[model samples]
Target: MSVFSRFFPQAQVSLVHCEENQVILTAKNDKTAESEKRQIRLIDLAREATPATCNLNPLLFNGHLQTGWTTIKETTEIPIYYKRKIFEQEIPALAGQFAVDFVVPAYPKTTDPEATDEARKYTLPSGLPARTTFFSKEELAALPSNDTKPMLVALHGLTGGSHEVYLRAALAPLVLDETAGWEACVVNGRGCAQMKLSTPLLFNARATWDVRQVIKWLRKTFPNRPLFGIGFSLGANILVNYLGEEGENCLLNAAVICANPWNLDVTNIALRSTWLGAEVYSAHMAVSLVNLFNQHVDELTHHPRLNVDDMKDVKYIHEFDRAVQCALWGYPTEGAYHRDASSTDSLLAIRIPFLAINAEDDPISVKQAIPYDEFKQTPYGVLLTTSWGGHLGWFELGGCRWFTKPAANFLNLIAKTIDLSVTPMPEKDKEGLYGETLANGSIHKPSHPSVFYPVNRKLSMTIDN
Candidate 1:
């Protein structure tokens, strides 16, 4: 028997990539790679295959598993599974470290400006500087002057900027699609990735003002385009809070959040309580924050509330947050900052379709910190928990990285659902009546003055007679 027959005997599999011991395989009928096919065949195969074992719920393995997103059943407890080897490498909080050690650094780097067609800077009302890098400008320009496409605005994680690996992964699916007419952009937070901060204040999980400003700008810039938000880690926390704070008034049509630190208090405690968390994760984060602060120390020293002496002893994330984050933001204590900044309590207020994905083995954002009950109760919120993806390190065999495809799929699904062409009808409705055929083969009449009708789901356009 071949590798496919031996391992996945029931399914037709296609090999995507292979290098030495690593082999990437996918379902034969995967839509994303329909045009591409690999010629390699599995020649050396054994009769007996080792049974794969991991903590991932068996329910997740069933079905086609296109994007690896298992719909949350009615149960509150969600089970996540990882391939045995992947699980073994996923040491809570150290998964990323292991990935960096083994995985070749072939992902797009910060120097690749081609990822975005244009870059624009905005100074928030509070004088904090932020930047937006846009994709698919040429495609947008080709459309009619009044026509607009759906836009996805991504926010990077802690100490990450627009050019980070996750942002690139999120952008890869839609940025080059001329037919889909989808546009993407990144919202770089203040003082990240060498960006100069005009104000002394750096963004935290509660700093929704910068994101709000970016959304407002995107709206003003492209008034007709439907907006969607995708945030990772710390950025995901901020997006979740912003959605809850805005409630029904939130401008986003939908959202996808991955590896969010829903409960900062629990996350901070986890980071300090364990050897892996303290030495690997917290140390890395603290160093990045310290470097950023030191680069802007001259300007930060002038801020009335900040005490530079307190920052000297900050060796861990909790200490850093207490000395600088809480102090700069005017929170009396670190506990107060973590409590107030957490998005878990705020999830209930979100009214728009929101998907939050977390890994149970995630070292930094402890699985216990996830608010599954709240997620289940929230009307528009969907939670997907996997057993083994380590803190944004969802790498698979054969060079495939997970998370991005599912995120892109979610974005596309929501983009199709939004009604983009709702226009005012003329006084004589009957005179301008026109029949438009929908995907379901139903005729939609836009003759009525105030009545809404479904148009082609694929194309968000509607006819106003």
Candidate 2:
């Protein structure tokens, strides 16, 4: 399947390149790609939009690098932090982020396996209990006996799979454990079976009000340990907004968000109007929401509000917006809700070390959406834009184990931020081309070296305890 077809069914990939500050993706297809081939669907964007009525920065001053003005027949002196390039490597794509040895030890036949036992007390409507998994602190305990390791809470983006599935299946064992030495706890944010979200509280932003409660419990149980939060897309938006409003009060040391839609109103509108933005992008989100709400008897039979069938011809975001608005509040549009829930206006107030990861190509997170001037000047916030990684799609560029190394690097930044010197990997007989040390003290040399060119940024962040 084409990259666009696999990642974003609705939008077309007119252009894909590693731009300096972000990955630039121009839309060519906005209709949903076939479901069987869909990988991860992100919202889409137009190269240009309805003249932004919003006056973003009154203190508006733009600093552009020469390339930012390329072919424009003018010279501007905005600083270019890094060079932009389009790279294609000839090698089997084995990124570090996806490299994990999945081993499920046989569940030793339980002595007395009972469905309704106290040990299995956390029952689900699906007849499943609050399933819990405890990851060993071996890596953290070994990081340094003198200090406590930071704990990382991973929240997945929408439909990105198990709310905490990514953490348990991919991050915990493979990347986070060996390198960062973080105590990784993957919690299934609401609607997930283990930690099901109340039906009344599922779709709206207020649902996030509960994360603070979760953090409180974690802090109380594991006193004195520093905590870090990582969120993607919807999760990212929720986390950033929460941090902005609350300011990392109880146990948060640092946070990172990937592919977050900065402007909710524009994004909501874009998903309704833009070619790829609305057609396929918003449709999926609308479908998920509609399907979720259909479980509500009152919502299902209600007219004016959308039943799943009512959404069959629902193509644009505006229609979906109308449906949701009607169901949520007796309204016919996405006005009041947009103003109340969006985090676009709240970014200036954010005062934590927030690392936002986004791509220009991601439909949900557009370049214009980033309040660059507002965020860049803020002492505690920095936006890391990449060339590619669809929605949460920032994978290893070229043939490097894209997932493993880069993710490890980000996790390392978190641990390092806490002033903990992440132990460098042990000596390897032979290291991979990307320089990542293999776990078995031996490197698996593919037919060709994996070539991943990292956008070099002088990370001068100092961790002040």
Candidate 3:
């Protein structure tokens, strides 16, 4: 031992992981065989190591005090920075797995059983069998009793359910309120969350039929109530595609999407790239998808279209899509499915107010993968790109997540823009329709292709005088 170490007899501290402003450390002492470990404030460690160099601004580093959005530029800003340094962006991005792994201890834990017990499950009416879990009226008591308030429909990512950590975190900000509180439900894809598939069909990024059924059911179940949607990752891609496909006829007043892989082909390429992308992300997702398929292997093997022998060696996401998803869905090949499934082609068709939030440093969906030009072209869509917030890991100190509040705020803002109380023009007026004046004083003629048309034949509408 060095003379200084012998005199001081201090325990050796090594960093296990450093995420944003938090550092997990393991300490060992020559005097004792046991090792001690704990999480400490990174700023404190920096100050202890070099006080003069470690003078971090509390506004940027203090997690408890740091709340609310940092307006970096207009609608886009650095969202809830645990550490404001540019180089430190990767810390939280890489720590996403750690956050997810200890989700129970990090945040209030909820399981599938717990969620099912509190919710009313209903199978959606669609070509392919799917399910939705609606929170009981008792659980949503904070919402307006008269159904004036909007319902929040959330969609989970690949291999995720309503009880997933990120889903729970996203819904944390919602609570019972007279006007502001929104009732929520999770629209699970076919075979997800233990929902038995009645058909041999499953959902893909471009498949919006299940979403349509869920919205239709919600509208029928709760008349006059507006609807809003929030989708994560794969779910986000589906929502975006649905919005594009339905255009002005969409039931949703607004939507908030996070970490959407708009370009499936590009995203797949990124996942299959080098050490971090291939070994970390692609391998992890591939394993999860394969395991999910394995659960239904007996039924899948019986299907004449699917090659059971090919599925046994499925090791990559592309392989799974090629072997099972594409074959079952009747797509000629995986490339065809990916091409049609990409939401980028349909972004311009979306008419409702929508917000898409993505982290620039997100490892799975690289910064270059986003279609910034397309976002600029879309009048109603806003892209909020944060410098650092690893894929779905917008974590703050003290277990406080950052994405939910801003998302809710955006939802509320858009909800105000839509006057759901306005009744549709009478069907008789459709014959004599010439031009209509919008709230913004823009006159839109029926000849205009972009003009809103009522899809429900029975619903009557009237132009505001």
> What is the TM-score (0 to 1) of candidate 3?
0.62
Query: Worst 10-residue stretch by lDDT in candidate 2?
Result: 94-103
User: What would the C-alpha RMSD of candidate 1 be, to one decimal place?
Assistant: 17.3
User: What is candidate 3's lDDT per residue for 246-312, written digit by digit as tens?
Assistant: 6656778778888888888888887787676776577678898887676656655756798878877
By TM-score, is 1 or 2 better? 1
Candidate 2 Cα misplacement greater than 4 A, ranges: 1-147, 159-176, 193-199, 248-250, 295-322, 325-332, 397-407, 420-465
- lDDT at position 33, candidate 1: 63
Tens digits of per-residue lDDT for model 2, 1-465: 888444432221122211222211122233645332222111111112111121111111111111122113112222111110111111122100110011123233234443235223332345432122221344223322334656666565553323223233335433334454556544344433332222322334322444554565556656656677777666677676566555323256656666677676767765656766665667666666555444443423533344555556655545655555445444444655554555554443343445566555566666667666655333445555544434543222221212223344544544553232211111222223322212111223356655421111122211111
Q: List the residue pairs that clash in candidate 3.
A: 93-390, 142-176, 142-177, 424-460, 424-461, 424-462, 425-461, 425-462
lDDT of 2 at 334: 60
Cα error, residue 369 of model 2, in Å, equals 1.6
TM-score of each: 0.62, 0.55, 0.62
Q: List candidate 1 stretches off by more than 4 Å.
A: 1-145, 417-465
Stretches > 4 Å off in candidate 3: 1-146, 176-179, 416-465
